[model samples]
Every structure is written in C-alpha cells, then in structure tokens.
Target: MPSIKAALSKPFAKLIAKRIKKWASQPLETQEKVFQNLIKKARKTAFGRDHNFDSIRTYDDFRKNVPIRDYEALRPYVDRVVNGEEDVLWTGKPIYFAKTSGTTSGAKYIPITKESMPTHVNAARNAILMYIYETGNIKFVDGKMIFLQGSPILEEKNGIKLGRLSGIVAHYVPKYLQKNRMPSLETNCIEDWETKVSAIVEETIKEDMTVISGIPSWVQMYFEKLIDKSGKKVGEIFKNFNLFIFGGVNYEPYRAKFENLIGRKVDSIELYPASEGFFAFQDKQDEKGMLLQLNSGIFYEFIEAEHFFEENPERITINDVKVGVNYVMIISTTAGLWAYNIGDTVEFTSLRPYRVIVSGRIKHFISAFGEHVIGKEVEQALREAIANTDITVNEFTVAPQINPSEGLPYHEWFIEFDIEPKDESKLIQKLEASLQKQNSYYFDLIEGKVLKPLVVTKIKKDGFQTYMKSIGKLGGQNKIPRLSNDRKIADTLYKLELTK
Candidate 1:
C-alpha cells in the first residue's frame, strides 16, 4: 500500500513521463528552443556583449563568435562574480556557487542561476518519478530514503551562498519528501565522513529504509557499517529496500560488491549530473545509457575526442551526432557557461532520442606510451575479467608504470578486492586480452613487445580509503579517477601500502 503522498505523486509521475517522452522524441526542436532562450537571457550581460551574443542568430554564428573554454580560461569572468559584481557572466548574480576541488586553481566555483537551479531539483525528482511510471513500484516512496552526501551547511559570500553541489541540493529536497528523507540535519552536518556514515547507519538501521542513493563506493562503506552494527546483510536489515540511485562515477565496477553486501538484487537507476546542470538520467530501466535532457535549459555541443586538442575542431549539435563515437561534450547553459568544455567524454548509444554513456574524461587518460587507454576501456576489461569469477572488487585504479624497477614497463593496476580470485595469472591474461581488443594502439604496443604484460598490484583492505584520508579527500563526492597519465596518485598508493 502506498501513502497518500505516494498515491498522489504516482499519477503526476506518469503525466510528466509522457511530457518527457514528447520532448525527448523531438531532440532537435527541443534543443533549438533552449538555445534561443539562453541567447535572449545573456544578450545584455557583460560576457554576452564581449562575445557578441547579440548578433548570434544560429548555432553557426554562435560557435564562431564564442570560443570553447575550460574553467581556467573562463576564470577571469568568474572572478568578477565572486567579487560581488553583477551581469558579468549572465544576467544578474548567480543564486549560488557549486564549489568543487580543482587540481591547479584550487577550489572552483561554478555558478547556479535562478533559472538553472530548479532544473537540478526537477531532473533528480523526475528520474525517480520516471522510474515509478515505468516499474509501477511506489512502495519505496512510502518509506525512508537516504542520500549520502556532503554536509548541507553553506557559507555566505557577497550575499550569495557557496557549497558542495550535493550539499546545495540537500536544501531543495521537496517538502512532501522531507519526512521520508533520513540522516537528521544534525547528522548531515557532521564534517567527518566516517562519523557521518556511522550516524546515518544508527539513524537508518531501525527505520523502514526503502531507497538508498549516493556514489556506490561510499554507499558500499555505509552498507558495510550497517551490516556490522545490525549483524545481518542489508537485505535482511531493511526488508523493503528496493531502489538504488547513483551518479558521479560508473556503477558497473561496484555492482558485484554491492550485490554481495545486499545479499539480493535490487533495481537501480543511473544519473548523469554535474554542478553545471543536471544533464541526463535513466528514464527506462532497460536502456544502456541515460536519456539526454534536451529541453532542460541547456544547449549541447560535441567535438570528436580525438580532435579535441586541435585548434578549431568541429563542434556540432545533437542533430549531427552519430552513434558509438567518442566525443567531448560541451555546453552553453542557462547558468551562463558559454561554449564551456565540461571535461567529460561521452559516446552515443542511441541516435533517435539521443542517449549517451560517459566514455571517459578529456584529460584523464593513459597515453604515456602512445596507447591512449580510456576509462571505459579499462573498466570494461576489469569487468570482463571478473565475470563468473569469485572476485568481487571493492575499488581499483589504473596507471602506467613508465619506468619500472624490473623489465619493460607496463600498465599497473591497483585493485582492492573484497573477494580475491583463486587464479590470479589467468585473471591478468583475461584483463590484458580484453584491453588489447578494445584499443588497437595498446594492442600494437603489446604485440610489438614495446611493453610487458600488465601488472596487478593488490591494495590492502581500505587502502583507497586511507589514501583519500591522507590527502584530506576522504569521502563525500570525492572519487579517485580511474586512470591517470602520471604517478601522482600511483606513488602515493605505493607509500600507503608500504606503511600498511
């Protein structure tokens, strides 16, 4: 039986699902409309005048007049907004800044406008509603749902608020769902992730928990804590737990470990969200990728990932994109990001309604030896190698061992296993074979004897957690990149393992 709120929300979910299908079916028209509105909004602003947004009549003119820029390139305009200036990037000041850690620039402040803020909340809400419309399971709505995220506490700067995107979103959980949300405000405010997860487990262990949402790695930590305190698997502790919603990182790598912890299968929905905007989410349970949010106050652009580093690479809209090609995603959003490169690479899975799967990051790849192995390829290799085996991997990362102490250098895999496999040598063969299949460059390098067979370095239990803690990025939206071009993290992991 559903609660009164759940009963009412069910029909409304169906209605919105219909509306979503209507727009998703007309990707080009929906995006054109969003593009027009963004240009109209930015025409009077400082960035608009400088970029000549006034004379931009079509995507061609807009692309020519505005150059694609990363966060560092656009920081001059953002510094103005941070210093209490108005109409610098977009119309008026941003309502809030989504703060995230940056490697070179320190903390990055991404603006969230009055127009763009609601889309974040609505997209997250509609993701669940679309799930209900498709599956007809609103029973989860009648029970508690917990979102493991950063502290909701925010800081005021120049009459505007700034905080982690997840924490900023915590303030916008709809009123009707407030009673059903877990981890008391006091509990959420705890700064330390270990303490926060402990408090969350204490609060939710006895409750009728039906839904759990967060990064899978952190959620795994929380689930282990619950099992430790309750003396039962998560499925046994919370009989009604039915849905898992996750984003920020690929969930495939953690799926097997989660199934072991839960002791049963549960439905899952994947989402593609960022501080810039809620870009996409899983609208159909059976789909391979998320439905691109065409009408959500964002205009999308793409450039072939291989050509992205070249000056003036072709930038095309959704109408021109094809399936299965890796492309770097760019956006001109209502939040006033103009031709902004969000640093993510995506591959299209469907062209009719424009569905995409995140392939990798533009900068995060291993090309040290001319074998540009991507995040997707490495993850797929690991996933394939672990299939049907007793291995359940907790976490893993890849880096090129450029200069090894031994023979020829090769790719080094740092894997933390929840259930170690019996045959380790066979596992490496499977992994290397899979990678060679997906990447021709890597294959040539391996076949040519330019590199040795990949090495698998076993990371001690909680080694990743310890590494993250040593660097002050323990949890809460922080994730280790799947691969890197350098040993910044690889060397650190080796040191952590030595101390352990």
Candidate 2:
C-alpha cells in the first residue's frame, strides 16, 4: 500500500508547483501593493497605533515615519512582551520567544506570535516544495526526513516559552511527517549536542533516510558518527538519501569533504533562516543564488553596507537594489519587528527573480587597521586558494590580532583541516594573496607597513567542535562566526588549547 504521506505530498507538491510559478512571475508593483495591504491590517494593532502606522499611506510615508531599529533598540519592547505584557509589540503575548546567541551585543529573544508562526512554518515547507517542483524530485516524502535539530523541550520564562528556532519549527512539523522523522523525540531533548548526536546515530543507523537537514558542520559530525557506527560510507548506508538541506554557514569549504564521505555528489538546497525570520532559499537548481521571498509577510529594506556606519545613512527598498552591492538587511514583520536591523549583509546575484547571496554579518569583520575585511572576502579567498589544491578545510575563523608589543597588527586565521595539503606553506601564501586581491585596503595596509602578513594557525582536531560544546552552542541553527573585529572568540579558542 502507498503511504498516506506520499499520497498527500503529491497534491501539496502540485499546489506549491503552481504557486511558485505565479510567485516568480509576480510583478514588483503587485508585491509592493500586497505589502501595503499588510501594513494597513497591522495598523489596527497596539504597536501600529503607537508607531502612527495609520498615518502611513505609502512606502515613503512608512519609511519617513519609522526609524530603523537594531535588536537592541527593540529589546525594550521585547522585554515587556516577555514579562507578561500583552498588546505591546504584537496583538497579544508571543506564543514563543526564539532564543539566539549574541552577535556582540548579547543574546536575543525574538517574538514568534500566532500570525508569524505560519511564516516560519510555510517558508521552510515552501523552500523544499519549490525545490521538489523545480527539480521534479519528490522521493523524500515516501521515506524519511532526518532534520538534525535542537531540543524540542522548551523552557518557560514568565509564562512565555523560550527555545531555539529549529526546536520551535519542529513543534509545527506536519502531522504527515511525524511518522517519517527520526532520532526519536527522546534523543532530541538531550541538551548536550555530542550526546544527542551519539544517541541519534545509535537510533537511526538502521533506518532508511531520504533527506537530511541542518548546519553543514553538525550534519558533517553526524555523518562521521554514522560512518563510525556502520563502518560504511554514507552512500552505502543510506542509498536512498538524495536531498541535503543546509543553512547558517558557507557550504563551499565543506562541499569537497561531503562528496568524499558520500562517494558522490548529491542535490542540495541552501536557506537563509535567522532568529528574525526565514529570508530566502535556493529555489532553482541551476540558479546562482536563492530567490528572495517578496510576498512573505515581512516588509524588507536595505542600507548600503559601506554606508551603514555613517550618520543619516540612506535606506533603499527592495525595488531599488542593484546587483553586486552589499546591503545590510532591515525588516518589519507580522511578529512586531518594525524596521528592525537583523545584522546580516547580502549581495544580490540576480534581479529578475530577485535572488540573493548572503555575504556576511554586519559585525563579522576585521578592520583593526582600517582594511575592512568582511566574511565574503574571507570565504572567496579560501575558495580560490583551495580551488586547485587537495586541501579540505573542515572549519575556520578569522580575527584581528593587535598587540603593540608584538610590533604590527595583522589578521589571524584559525583553520581545522579534514585533508591536509601536501604543501602547507604554498596554501598559506595562496590564501594571503587571494585575500589581498579581494580587499585592496588590506593590501594597501600591508604595503604601508601598518599591518603584518596574514598569519595562519592550524586548529587542533575537533577543536571547534569542543569549543561549541563548551559554550552550549553546538547544534542546529548555531554556527561559529567566520570573522570577528576583536579577539574575544579567538582568545577563548586559544584558551581551549587548540592552537597549532
């Protein structure tokens, strides 16, 4: 007998197929009009009344009236909502608060109300659905989807629930998928990531999994465990696995390692989901970037990342964005975030269907000597350096090393290698050269003797994994920042005795 899940997926997939086509062909004007309609509806809420949302008629009016806010600026309102305050930020108290690790400021508690839950749930569903429709691959529904997720057991904070975003998303997983999901709820609630992964490996080693999703690092950990437990390659153990879904970090550095483990290349999807909202996802297999979600309830705005630090910086809307320019993202959503800066930076790869490639975070950069090196530049540098080499860098992080006693300041790279290169010196030289080519300012600083040559530090085996475990940020939706303007994280890693 055919599975009910499989049968139900056929019609749901067909519906998503049609909707994605219509959504892709949707005009910018139509999307803007729909956004305005949403704003009109929100204006009746308490938050709207306080912000004079009723007085807004046009996008221009909305922008002029609402000052762009960072997570810190919105923290006051969020605190109220957490402390049993209703109709403050949203219509009522949030159903849950999506807890996230701090960028630099501190940890955040983002509200997820009844209205906004669907945006999280449907956006994720639609990402896979769109991929299924575009690629004509629906074999996943027939088998199982093993989402490497956080603990579903939520903690209560003054009558309000608090948990990781991935955990909260699991709560809303479709009933049809409940039977096909893995690791068991018992294993998922294990707070320690390593223990949880071990339990998951033990439980799912014999299951026929068709799809898997999580941050590439954690998934890679799981893959290693599976190989250890089964004494077989991933492809051999799970022959039916076809789709790999991932987000929260750059997938380039890990791609080669993944292929080596599986013994073949598999279709994969990339997503841009944050504590703030699910932003975009890779829709078409052939496309260079993920398509932006225009009709999602979130209203989007952008500020040129270069000008973001300037006083009275100009804010640009979705219709005005140009390709290749890095922009800091701001959003106002149904969850009561009004013109909130989410701290991410992205560059549009295509404008026709509005596709974007996440560049880096607003705070994730090294500019100690005014060189302004961002995560995009670092990843590009690594990609170019490893392009022709036999190197497989497992994970890496960059931070500024400034010490007047040490003479000159320079950027330091801490890398964990899965497959070491035959020529380590050659690889380092290539990495430095590529970085200089990517950031002219960094090159200029080197020429002026204001900074030393880039330093490469080989991290201990499983160094990053151990560090993440120590900090309790070890699983889904949590990723180590690739770059930092300061040495806090680097010093901490060094303290863990990881330096080579």
- Which candidate number would show the highest lDDT if scored against the true structure? 1
Q: After superposition, how far is residue 219 of candidate 2 from its true place, in Å?
A: 0.7
Candidate 1 lands at a TM-score of: 0.99
Tell me the deviation in Å of residue 277 in model 1.
0.8
What is the TM-score of each predicted model, taking all chains together?
Answer: 0.99, 0.95
**Tens digits of per-residue lDDT for model 2, 1-500:** 55776656667877986876676677476568656865776776766787788888888888778889987887888878878888887677888999987665577899988887887888889888877677766777788779998889899998989898989988998887799888788988888888889998888888888898999999999999999888899988989998999988889888988988887889999998877778888988988888887767778889999899998899888789999999999898878888999889999998888899999998888888888889999998899888976788889999988983677888889999888878878887888899888889999998899988888888988999888878877776778899999898799888989877
RMSD of each predicted structure: 1.0, 1.9
- lDDT over C-alpha atoms for residue 425 of model 2: 82
Q: Residue by residue across 321-428, what tens digits does model 1's lDDT show? A: 999999999998988898999999999999877889999998899999989889999999999999988899988889999888889989999999889889999999
Scored against the true structure, residue 183 in model 2 reaches a CA lDDT of: 73
Clashes of 1: 0
How badly does each model clash, as a count of residue pairs? 0, 0
**Cα TM-score of candidate 2:** 0.95
Error of 2 at 71 (Å): 1.6
